[model samples]
Target: MDSDIFRHGGNTTCDIKQFTIITDKEMRNSMEYDVIIIGGGQAGLAMGFSLKQKNIHFVILDENEQTGMSWRKRYDSLHLFTPRSYSQLHGFHLKGDPNGFPEKNEIAAYLNAFKIKNDLPIIHQEKVIKLTQNEKQKFLVATPNKTHKAKQVVIATGAFYNPFVPNVHDGTANFEIHASQYRNPSQIPNGNVLIIGAGNTGVQIAAELSKTHQVTLSQSKPMKSIPQNIAGRSIFWWLETFRIGRAKPNSFIGKILREREPLIGNDYKTVQNNVEIVGRLSEIKEGKAYFNNGITKQVQNVIWATGYRNDYSWIQIDGVLSNQGRPLHSFGVTNVAGLYFIGLSWQRKRSSALIYGVSDDAKYIAQKIQQHEMK
Candidate 1:
C-alpha cells in the first residue's frame, strides 16, 4: 500500500521495481512450457487443463497462496446464479447437489480439486509484474521473484481484478471503504446506507443489507433484472434452454435487452419496492450524498457499485491495447504474436462473460493457439 503509487484520480502510478532476469543457468534448471497462463482463476485453470489434454506443455501462474484465492476472498454469502452443472470446469462435471447453485467456498474447492485432479502445473504466490515480448517473440514474464520466458502467453486474468469506486467529492479520507474492501453486511456501519450503482453487485448487497439496515439504491440508468425463478424453473434454466444467455452482445436483441432490462438476480423481485430508489449521486460532502435531484441524505455508509476499469497497465506489449484500455483482439488473438486472451466480455459473443459461456470462448482461443502452433 504505497500512498505515492496512487495518483489523485485514484489510478495507480507504476514505478518499475527491480527485477532479476533469469540467467542461462536458471533457464536450464527451470522447467519451460509451451504456454504460460498468467492467472489461476476458473478460466486460467480450464485453459491449462485443455492444453494439458492435448499433451501441450503449459504452466499456470497465480499471485495467491493457493488456487481459487479470488473466490475464497470474496464475500461469504456470494453464490453463483448458474447451477453447479453449467459452472463446472472443462473435462469434469461438478458432482455435488446439482439442484443448488454453488457458494463461493464450494466453487473455490471445486477449482482446487480441478487443479489437483488434472495435475495442472501451477506456480502459486507468483504475481506477474511485467509482460513484454522479446525480439525473438518469446514472452518475458517478470514476477517479483524472477523472470521466465515462454513461447506463448495467455492473459486469463478475470474481469473483476479491479474494483471501480467513483471518487467522493470531499475525498475518501474519512470513510474507509470501497466495494473491494467490503466482505459482508457487517462491515457497513450500523445506519442507513446509500448505495450507488444498481447492478447485480449493488442489488445483491442492498437486498442483503436491507435485512438489518436502512438501504437505498441509486441508479444512473434503469437496469434489466430477472428473478431467480420463473414458472417453476430457475431463470437460469430458461436462459440456458432458450440460449438467451448465449446471445451475442452485439446482436440487435442483445443490445436492446441489455439497455432495457433491469438488473435481476437469482430471486425474482427480491428487492422490496418500498426501498428507496433515486437518481445517481452527484457528490458526497461531509458524509452525505447529493443526488442529481437536488436531494441530500446523511448516511453512515455508501457502497459504490459503479463498475470496473480494465487495468492491464503491467502488460508491456505495444499495440495490443486500444486507447480505451481494452485489449485489441479478434477472437482473443491480440495484435502481438503468440499472445491470446479469453474470458473477456464480448470477446466473441454476448454470453462470453457468463460463467457457463466462457468455456466456448476458451475453446475457441485454444483452437487458435493450436493452429498457430501448427504453423
Candidate 2:
C-alpha cells in the first residue's frame, strides 16, 4: 500500500513501514521458538505484540502471501462495522477517526503498520498442516515443506473459515461465487443476481450488486437489523458503556447480543429499497431458482454469502477439541499444556473474535504462557 493512502475520515496518512513478506520456500527447513502462533490476523498479531513486550521468543505464521492480505482480499466496498476506535489491535493505533469506520484496505494497511511498528516475527505463506505433541512434551507443527518446534502453540487463526456454499447438484445458475471470492459488481454476471444467506455478508453483497443488477435475497427470513448509532453515539460505544459486548456467553444478555443481527451501514442504505427479499432456497433446476415460498427467479449470477465452519483437522490432539471440532479453551487457555487459542467466537466474550476485542484474549494468553513457563 502507498504511504499517501490516507483515510479521508481521519485525514491521516499512514507513516509507518511494512513488514517483510516471506514465502514458504524461503522458510527454513526447521525452526524452534518459545511460542508459535498460527494465523497473522488481529488475534495473532496482538499476541505477537504482547509477547514482544515481555521479550518472549515467538513467530506468527499465516498462509496469506502479504502482510495483511486477509483483509486486502475481501470485497472492494468492505469496511469495519465498528468505528475506528473499536477496530485497533495492541501496540498500534489505527490511523482513522475514532468515530469513523475504515474501509477494508485501510485495515490491511493498519495491520501492516502494526506488524512493522512492533517488529512482530511473522512468516507469510506458511500454513500449518498438522499439529501434534511429541513425547518430549513440546509441540511439533508440520507444514508441507518444513517442521517447527515450540514450547507453546497459540492458534490465533481468527474465524471466517471455509465458505459454506450450498450445492444444488444441478447447476441452475450460470455462475456462482462466494462473498469471499467476490471482488466487485463486475464479478457478477450480466443478468440478474440471486444472493443466499441473509447474514451481514449477504446483505452487504446484495446491496453492492443492486448497483448494476437486479438482486433477490433468498433466505428463510430477513436478517434482523439494529441501528448503527444511537442518539449521538455509535452503537459500539453503548455496547461498551453498557458492558453488552463483554457479556458472558451463557448470560441471557450475551445470548441476545450473539444472535446474528444484520447491521445496515452506509454500504447497504442506498440499495435497501432496490433489492427483493425471498424465502429460503428450496431448489434449483433448469436455470431457475426456487424458494420455499414458491418464489422462483431466473438469475445468471448467484452469491453464496453463507457463514463458515471451524476446521481444526490439523490439531491432532485428543480431548482438546469438542466433537464439533471447536477449541475447548477457557479465556484462550486450554487444558492441554502450553496449548491455547484466540480469536474464536465467544472464546471469552461476545467480542472475543473481533478486532477490537482480540487483544484482551491475546494479552490473557500471553500471561498464561508466562505463568506456565514458571511451572
Candidate 3:
C-alpha cells in the first residue's frame, strides 16, 4: 500500500487533520476500494480504524460534515449512562475521570479525536443514497457525490437514524411538534406540554422542561426503571459482570428483560417526580388529547419521544434485510456475502448498540473480513 495515499502531504500523520477535497463526481467516476463502510458513528469509525491497522484498502462514507455528528446533534442536556472509561474506543482510553459519564459534546470530541489519532479514512458529507450488489458479488454504493464499487460493504449506521413518531392524530397537524425538532425548552411556548412517549428521551426531556412548563407524559403501558447504581456499584458494572447486555436475544432472560424493562435515564426515579405520568393518548381532536382512562388534556406542545424505525430502502441488496428493514445478520455478516451490519441493537448480543460494546463487534467483523480476504 502506498503510504502517501494515507498522508496529507504535510507533517501531520493524522488522517482526520489531513483534509482531502475530492468531488462526488470524481469519486463516482474514478475511485474504488476493497471495502466501503457506511456511517461514521462509533461502530463505523472503529471498523475503519481496524481496517487501516490491517493495511486494508478501504474508505468510510458519512453524511455529516465531521465524524460523530450524531452525538453532536443530540439534545444539549444529553449524557451517556455508561461512564467515560467504558466508552473508550479500541486502542484508546478517554482522557478524564474513568467513573464519570461525559456529556454529549465530550463524546463527540472523543470520536473526532479518535479518528484523527488513528488516521481513519472517512469522507464526510457524502451520504449513501443506495447500495446494490453486482453480478460479481461486489457492492455498488451510490452516494450524493459518486458511486463507489467495493468488494465488501459494512453498514455501521447506528439505530437512531430514523425517528419513530406514531401515526398522527386527526388534529396532529393543528399542533406543532416532534421530539426531533426539539432543541431546547425555549423552542416550546410557555404552557402545558404533552410528551407522548415514556422512553428515556421522553422522560429526560420532560424532566428538564417541567421546571418551567406544565408537563404530562403519556405512556401506552406502565414503564419500569432501574437505579443507575445498585449496591455501591454502577448498573453497568453489574450488567457487564453478569453479561446482561451480552445475553442471547432468544434466551429466557433476554426475552423477559427486553419486554419488561422500561427505558430510563441514569437517574430514573428523580425524573418521575418532575413530570405527570398518564395513560396513552387514544385520540386527538380540536387540540385536546384523549387518554385511554377518560382523561382529557389540553396542551400547547407535544413531544413525541416515541422511538425510531429502521428503514434500509436505499440498500438494494436482496435477502440481506428482514421485514423490519434491519439487516439480518449473524456476527455482523448478512445473508448476502461481503455485506455486513454493525452498531445495531442485538446484532451479536444485547450490548451491540452500546458505545463501549460496538468496538468488540467491529473487531469481530474486521477479523471476519480479514479471514474472507485470506481465502
Candidate 4:
C-alpha cells in the first residue's frame, strides 16, 4: 500500500509491495457464516465491499497464499489493456495515473491495498474443493483442510480459470510454456520462440520477447488491431462515449462486439519488424509448425496464450452447472436457491468480468443474497 511501490516499475531497484498472509493458527475450523465467497481475487473483493456495506456475515476463501496472486503470477512486463480508470473496483480507485495503463505488479499491489483498506475477512490458501447443499438447504463449503457452513454461496472466481492450449503441438519443441508460466524473456533460452493465440497477452509477450529473440505469432483468426488511444484520448473513453463498453450481452451492439475481440493496444505494431505474424497454427510435428495458410517454420520454443475457460466441476450441486462444467446462470442468478455466480464474462454486460464492471454484478449478487435470507 506504500506509494513508493508504484513509483518503481520497469528496470528499477525498489522494494516490491508484498501482502500479509494469514497464518494457519489464525484460521478457525468449521466456521459458520451467512455467505461464503469462493475466490479472493478482484471479484470476491468487490463482493466483499457490497456485503460489508449491508453488514452481512461473510468470508472469502482464496486459493493463493496471499492477495493478488492471480495478477502477480501473470507474465512480467504485462500492462493492462484498459487504462487505470477502467481497471478499478468499487469504492477504490487505482493509485497513480488514471489515463495511463498500469503494469501487472501495480494492479496486484492495488488489490492488496484494497483488501487492507476495506478490512475484508479473507481466509488465504483455503481453496474450495467442493460446494453443495445440505438437506436443510444450508450450503456446505469444503476446503482442503476444513469444511465451512453458509446460508448462501457466491462463486466469484473470474472467467480465467484454466490455461487452454490446443493439442496440436507435439513433444518436439525443446521447451514449452503457457502464458501463466512466462515471467520474462530471460526465462526463454536463446532460440526462436513461437507464441500461439493472437490475444492481448500473446501480442504483449511477443513484443517484449521480440527485442531479444526471434518471435513468431500464430493467430487462429484475423488480427484486429485497435490503437490504445485515439486523438489523445484512451480508446476506452470512446467506448464509454458510445456506451458500447457497457452494452448488454443480448443487445444488438453487444452481439456484434462479442463476435470478435479486437486487440486493444498497439504493442504488435512496434514489434512488427522484429516478430513474424503467421496464420492459424494447424499442427506441429517433428519440430515443424504448420500454419493454415501453408506456412511452416521450425520452432524450438512454444508459448501458448490461447486464453482460458471456467471450470465449475467442484460444485456438487445438481443443475447448477452444465455437463460441460460451465455454470448455468442467468446474469449471476442460478436456477438453484441460495447459489449465485459473479465475475462471469458477459454476466450482465460486456465488462462483467473486468475490475470496474464486476462491481455492478457483485452489488447485484449481494442484494440477491440479502433477499434470499429474508425469505
Off by over 4 Å in 1: 1-31, 172-176, 257-262, 266-268
Best by TM-score: 4
- Please write out the lDDT profile of model 4 over residues 1-375, one tens digit for every residue: 653332222332233233233344554654788889999999999998788877787888898988887888888788898898788777456667889899888888988887776677888878888998899999999987778999999998888898888888787999999998999999999899999988888988999999899999998888788898999999888888888878998999889888987887878686577788999999999999999999999989999998887777788999998878888888899999999988888999988988878988888998999998898
Lowest lDDT 10-mer window, candidate 3?
1-10
2 against 3, candidate with superior TM-score: 2
Best to worst by lDDT, what's the order?
4, 2, 3, 1
> Per-residue lDDT of 200-296 in model 2, one digit per residue for the tens?
7888888878889988888766566676778978988888999988988888987776775556465456546888888889877888888888877
How much lDDT does each candidate structure score?
0.73, 0.80, 0.77, 0.84
**Which pairs of residues have clashing backbones in candidate 3?**
24-145
Alpha carbon lDDT of residue 323, candidate 3?
Answer: 80
| Collision pairs in model 2 | 219-280
TM-score of every candidate relative to the true structure: 0.87, 0.90, 0.89, 0.92
Q: How many backbone clashes does candidate 2 have?
A: 1
lDDT tens per residue, model 1, 1-375: 111211121221122223323343544347455789989888898687667655666778888898877888877788887777567665355666665778888778777876765566778888999998878888899887778888889998876678877765675323445566668877876778777888777788777877888888888876566666689677767877887776676777678756675565642255555368888789888777789987888867777777777789999889988887788988788888789987787667656665666777777777877887898
Residues 24-114 of candidate 3: C-alpha lDDT, one tens digit per residue: 4555455688889999889898888777766777888888987767787888888887876567676466666767778888888888877
Better of 1 and 4 by TM-score: 4
